[model samples]
Target: MIKDYVSDITFQNLSHKHMSFERVFRNIEQFMEKDPTGNFKLMFGTDSQVFSRETRFITGIVIQQERKGVWACFRKVTIPRRMTNLYERISYETTLTEEVVALFTDEKKDSLIDIVLPNIYKGASLSIEGHIDIGSGKRNKTSIFVKEMMSRINTIGLKPKIKPDSFVASSYANRFTK
Candidate 1:
């Protein structure tokens, strides 16, 4: 079974047992090798759902390769620390996404960096994006933090995605958090 702490984090493929981080990277490498011309994007995002006593945070790492489709793995944590403030909650979510990105980028494999395409200029490069669960829609108060969160992501040299576009967080991670 999957645990809620990073130290015990496990990623699954289909119905099989959870795989370690190293194995996950190896799988991604093999997938890329099989499709050299595939358009790939490596995105990290997190979303949270608060309950009465604790909050659940789910972070997801998604590999989106054109034609090959999308593959994602997630780890979740249920914390007793309740974040009643909206800003605090959003910041925590961003931090979770950042942590996941750091784990992937800090890997010893140099080739992993080449797969992270941050811009179009890099030929067939894999882009690493942070999908923030904020939007510009007036109905949602979270929209107010879009600029602030975007700036934070930009300062870290990563592309930021808001709602309607931040499916990795608002959609993928959201499913597990609930």
Candidate 2:
């Protein structure tokens, strides 16, 4: 069932609905809360880093499932005025499946995390294991890479622009590689 939704999703074309960070996180939080299993955890954090001679904000959110003494956790790192991606490798447990492994690889190579800023969205994919796990009580700390792309869309409305073909066509500057 999850795979069906995953396959149907054109991740690159997420509607650019102009929403407050609070609204975005709140919507995501609500979605996570509807888990069938009565086990969910949410935490938010913030940090600062220097970029191009200026300090910028990096916000992170962690969601986890703890049931039957097992745990599955996914962390999303986002920068204000920038979109997020899950293509880099962080850390993960050894007991993982091929499909999950492939997902990370594809994400690194061909997936768009989020579209942020003017004409820029973060992109890249890396293979990190032991950070993202499926089923029961497991702990993984996978690191994903995100890039900023330059484009011509103003993502500030509830019905944000979503054009995958055009989005993938834009050029990126200083794309980070591993």
> Which candidate's TM-score is highest?
1
Q: Could you list the CA RMSD of all candidates, in the order they appear? A: 4.4, 20.3
Candidate achieving the largest lDDT: 1
Worst 10 residues of 1 by lDDT: 1-10
lDDT of each: 0.76, 0.25
**lDDT for position 52 in model 1:** 89
TM-score of 2: 0.25
Q: Each candidate: how many clashes?
A: 3, 38
lDDT tens digits, residue span 1-178, model 1 = 2224444666664444577776777777876666655678777788999998999998887888866788778877678977789999999899877766656654533575544444335456566688999989989999889998888777666789998889999999998887
Worst 10 residues of 2 by lDDT: 169-178
